[model samples]
Target: MISEKNKSNRAKQQTNHTAGRTSFVRLRQIRSESDEHLIDFFKEVRWSKKKGKFVTPATEEKHNEMVAKYSKLEPEKQTKDVVASIFREVLGHRPGYARGLGEMVIPESSRQNTVEKFAALTERAERHEKDAEYYKNQLEELGGNVEKVLAKQAEYDKLLSSYMESQRQTQGESHRETQGPA
Candidate 1:
């Protein structure tokens, strides 16, 4: 027979596990719905081989021209806006938008700044990790208490690991932002 405490813990664990799976399933459903909308939007547009871009029907003439040009080709042959839309929508990129005389563009500068910041942060993290190692070695050479030195080294290791993991997660998020829904 299980104790009341054990039963409660098991119930709590099962509830947490179920909640996680439920949230994951909900997220998947939302993504699927979003993908369907994107597909439908893309289907209404036509690709221009000559212009080498996906062309939405801004005008009837443009639409007719695109239809005539790409009708012979398969849908696979048509230039898909999946990548472009990903950049525009998910990554918040606006290729067509420009400031007066191109003095400043928010999207372009934002992307560049983000990349630069990430690079700087990664470099700083690497430097800090090296510095931590040097300090650990110096403490050992100076005959510091072994347990204290080891504990400090462990903390440094944990910090570096967390920093690297965060960096990886940031990179993954940016990569995903530039990728179309899947």
Candidate 2:
């Protein structure tokens, strides 16, 4: 039931296709692709149709070129590149390379690392909350009279700093006198 054109197309597709599957199917290819294979795809590909936005044929060539070059990379370089791509956004600013900032695809590997980091951050925030509550309860137990004590504490801190500064100046002058002008 296959027409000649269909047969020719199938034959063409079967040969030199990256994985015996033509690039016709989109995101599904990403899932079946190897770990090393996806880094370039993530680099070049973005959301097509994007809820009625135009599809770009531009990234296909870039993707193909990256894939071709990827096989030549040393294993260390490959890992470094994959890691840089995966974690670049959270670490700092880089204009357009961050994960959530643009349409760049996030690697599946980042999930656990991201979750662990977020867990630490939330734990610190919770500790701060608990500390604040403890301080509030302690203040309430002492008739909530905190302003005068806090003001005196601030004055004490300033006086302590001034005293330390004067002591440092005195020691520095004595040491300089002993040195007798470098």
Candidate 3:
């Protein structure tokens, strides 16, 4: 026969294991639901918004045309903004909002669109890097110019010092001459 303490310990262990399993299942279910929502949103954006243009269309003119077309659609038909607003609303419900850098909630319809938008943002960022490189080169050119100016100023300073010393010596000689036999 087992002691009461042993039985209690075994019961506790079992409870812990069961609790762990339950938590794991809950997490898995949440992830799956999130994924399903994302895929649905992606499909909506791909087929309904851009007419199945998986990648964003070229040129701002084309993009604006697509956005205008998307905006004209009904709420149920709206892919980006509606979904984004819904996602924002859900994220607002999270307690972490009070703290800085909280995790955002993804609306079922906006998740995929958000992901694709992220990709677009990254592409735009790369373009900005080209601009950054241009600025960097400009900075280097300016630095070279500043160095040249400093060197010229140093040369002028040396010349000014030598001229002042000669003037001092001439004044001393004239003082001696004026004294006459001093």
Candidate 4:
């Protein structure tokens, strides 16, 4: 009972809806790629999905206001050192702190110290490994010796039992002769 014209219009609408969804997905992909670049640029910052914003120390203005407030305090209460301390407390430390502390220093001594410590640790590990292998070999040798001793003891037990049986038979015969045919 559907009209031919209405059916063609519905088909056209479905095609448009699908195309719209495809375009929206592509847009999202492009946005996400840009977001990745932004995240890389702001290493110490994080994206807050709940607030829909980025949180970073560099982007904050509160620190400047706080510094000004602290600077205006009574001379006894606030000094240059006090302001610097407040700034340090507010900013804590950034990822570039170490790099900024020594701009281009190679820190060769520390690197050499670390390498020496690592080499010492590796050598100790190898020594312990060798000791473990030696102990394992010694254990195996002890086990083999124990097995040999047990086998020899079993043979000795068999021989002793045979000798005791022969002695008992000889003793029985002698007792019978001495008793005169019991």
Query: Quick one: best TM-score, which candidate?
Result: 4
What is the C-alpha local distance difference test score of each model?
0.51, 0.55, 0.52, 0.54
Per-residue alpha-carbon lDDT of candidate 1 for residues 102-140, written as tens digits (9 for 90 to 100):
213334346788899999999999999999999999988
Give the residue spans of candidate 1 off by over 4 A.
Answer: 1-109, 144-182
Write model 3 residue lDDT over 1-182, tens digit each, in one string: 57988887665531111122334334335556553342233233233333434333322233344455556668786654454344334323443331111234332466698999999999999999999999999999999999999999999999999999999999999988999884
By lDDT rank, best first, the candidates go 2, 4, 3, 1
> Local error of candidate 2 at 10, Å?
23
TM-score of every model versus the real structure: 0.22, 0.29, 0.39, 0.40
Q: Model 3 off-target regions past 4 Å?
A: 1-112
For 23-69, candidate 4 gives per-residue lDDT tens digits of 43343345555533211222223334456553433333433444466
Clashing pairs in 2: none
Best by lDDT: 2
Evaluation by TM-score, superior candidate among 2 and 4: 4
Q: Write the per-residue lDDT of candidate 2 for residues 7-75, one digit (tens) a residue.
A: 887564311223223242344355545553344334433434333321334434434444556556677
- Cα misplacement distance, residue 106 of candidate 2 (Å): 9.0
Question: How does residue 142 of candidate 1 score in lDDT?
Answer: 74
